[model samples]
Target: MTDSKLAIIILAAGQGTRMKSATPKLLHTLAGIPIVSHVLATARELDAAYTVAVVRHERDALVEVIVDELPNGLVVDQDETPGTGRAVEQAVASLPADFDGDVLVINGDTPMLDVQTLAGLINEHRHGGASATLLSAFLNDPSGYGRIVRTPDEPEQESAADTAARASTPLFGRRVTDRNGRVDRIVEHRDATDSELAIAEINAGVYLFGVSELRDLLPQLTMHNAQGEKYLTDMVELLRRAGSEVTVLPVAESWLVAGINDRAQLSEAAAKMNALIIRGWQLAGVTVQDPATTWIDLKATFEPDVTILPGTQIKGATTVARGAIVGPDTTLVDCEIGERAVVKRSDATLSVIGADATVGPFSYLRPNTILGAHGKIGAFVETKNAQIGDGSKVPHLSYVGDAHIGVDSNIGAGSIFANYNGVTKSETEIGSNVRLGSHNVFVAPVRIGDGAYSGAGTVVRKDVPAGSLAMNVAPQRNLEGWVATHRAGSAADVAAQAALAPQNAVEASAEQPAERTGE
Candidate 1:
């Protein structure tokens, strides 16, 4: 809300060693986009004057990828693997020499952060006229977080009575002002006394600082913590000691304070992000039934009043025009569905469905396929690289490929365009008002002219001219006496073999008798 120019510093310099991944952790996709992309998009939404992302990973390819995705920003490399404070310092060097506005620091991994919340933090920082403002939250168990220790608004008069009153007051209490909200001091857990550790307020790692103040105290940050890394948190103590104005404002939501250090935490953050997108769409007149089961791509755009049923996967630059109904089991990639089109239980890629077209119950539309207005693609149908004319119907059990069908044509069941050979693919052209019967195969490089009709069971290998009836069948001939001749020949052969067996035995006996009498 302030006219003061704002610059965003995204701390992406860490390698995310705890992710245990070979690829850079920020490069991993969340909802079909890299995690850092979401953060960058949010920053752009806030209309920040400039956004610089700090990188310190081993792979330069990661930085190149980020540069390609975010063309407007400069990618500053932190040559040394120091700490977050040093990462910011590297980014500060890249800032313009005339920079004189407020600086906002956000972690790149916190993609689920909301824009309005960040805007509020920036407004407060500018309004309070303080050196720095921290986004803080209270946790039930704030074990690992840095605690907030409030110096009494008016220092206790160093008397026994005042000390007793301080002990009786709340541990992490802050005085609230009407204009700028609550105020407190930040103390790290390791550096805090036992009394301070009892406080529940924790730092959420989001910071807003006066540009001049950051430039002044940045050199004082040191590697004094247990991790032996220069901490940005140390600057809070340094700023307060220097009598510079500092304050901690409680975050409106606790989830905004969470950080992802491992896979389990990452999953939690992703679930929260999923809910946010789904709820936002549902409120915008897009029906997302059973939000838990629906997966909408982060970049997929839907016009107002679009309905998305459960079990839908819309990804990869797909867009649905106004008043369209999709899914309940549909997958679409790089496809466009025109106004009021219906797509159910189908897989579509790189296709376009015209206004009021109806597809599926079970359909597969491959790349380059287009369905005209009021066209119908029914159950068990597949199409590839084909454009169906307006009001045409390919109803039930058909495969139409590499072809163009004229308007008002009716493609029958079990009809297929055999568009491919062992060597090459071909196309089939069907004219207007053509009627194809069941089980007809139109072998390709073929054409059916206007008002033509094909008989059932027809296998067409050639083109049919307009207004013709094409019937295909092989001629039949009857074998009249074939059964009788085969039966007589079988009887005679059986009788002859039976008589020859006895006569052969008698001849052998007579020959033996003559030989014995002569002897």
Candidate 2:
């Protein structure tokens, strides 16, 4: 790179009507982050001396998000002109008057442009000593793009044969390179003639301008064209007219400069970004099964040997440690998964799973929940604001909330920490080695001491002492013959009558036979 100090101006003012969204187009996400944010991150990688983001549509919301990411960076509001040229004008006005350096102007919606490409553009601009340099690409279908127009290096010849040959050749608007093969000018498709429209090289809308030259030319922009808007493309003609060298650097990867104008374009950018991220992780030793179905956020990190199964979305600063296996269907946000832990078919947020812990085949771990080492929170369990100590287990069909379980404790299936009353929420604390039976409910503000046993159906409202047993059920009792007495003329009554008639007939037969023999 040259010794010139760098400044970046990001144009984010357009309302993007084609997006058909209430949200600003720049705020639309690509790979779990706003498109503008991705651009900002790339700009940061350039180490620019100053950065400015111009916002007009949804200005307040856009500014808030931008400030959160770039607190010290400048933000300028584009005025009523509503054009790329006007947006850059506002950004330039906000900069220090004495600052004269290279300014990189980029569309905020073009998140696919990487740092290497941007740095390459800047280096090329600086070394070429050109007044301006714009990135260009050759597209098979350049229907909506501005075409690059250049003059051929061939000398004019007066010979009749040479003239006929030149005239017969289709040289109207084709890529005519100079002796050194450099770009001359760009013609918008609307203004290009039939032959000019056939040109394949199109402008990529990314440019680096000398700050002094750009500042001088911005005011001279006129809205005399079809759109009635001041176009930045006009600056190329203005610079060249002033006898300044304007050049174009062709980018091989056209997607690098592709803009997100609608839902379809946004999806395309996302898919491309997803592929890049997945490929990076695979090279780093993380196993991502079915990269097409797995969506990992830019801020997420995965340790080596971690396996992410299909249908998983790991978002928002989540980190998976080595040997951890997560998901065939799982979503984790801002959580930490320990080494060797397994989280399958679960959704977790703001939680922590300790080493060797096992969670879910279907579980929901909410904010502040922490499962300790070797602990297990099995299928159909949901926990929030709870902490399970090392070796503790809350397996299957349970809800543990606002509670703390000691080491080696077993929370039986169907048990619950009923920490909420009609008005307030409280906590339940169980000591080490406590045995809580199935269907037990530890009602708020209670504690069970070490070695305490809670029988099935226990609803503990009061605390239990050490080594104690707690049960909350009535003693056993029998209600024999109650069905026959109460259910008369019903199935029970008829069955009882039929059972007694057999015994009565047997006794009657024995007595009658003996009397007849004596007579």
Model 2 — TM-score against the truth? Answer: 0.87
Cα lDDT tens digits, model 1, 94-160, are: 8887889888899888877778778777876777778888777666677777876666763321222
Error in Å for residue 109 of model 2: 0.6
Best by TM-score: 2
Off by over 4 Å in 1: 1-4, 20-23, 58-65, 141-199, 303-305, 422-424, 469-472, 475-519
The true-versus-predicted C-alpha distance at residue 495 of model 2, in Å, is 12
Candidate 1 lands at a TM-score of 0.78
Provide the overall lDDT of each model, using Cα atoms, as 2-decimal numbers.
Answer: 0.79, 0.85
Residue-pair clashes per prediction, in order, are: 0, 0
Q: Residue 359 error for model 1, in Å?
A: 1.3
User: What are the RMSDs of all candidates, in order?
Assistant: 10.8, 6.3
Best by lDDT: 2
Q: What is the clash count of model 1?
A: 0
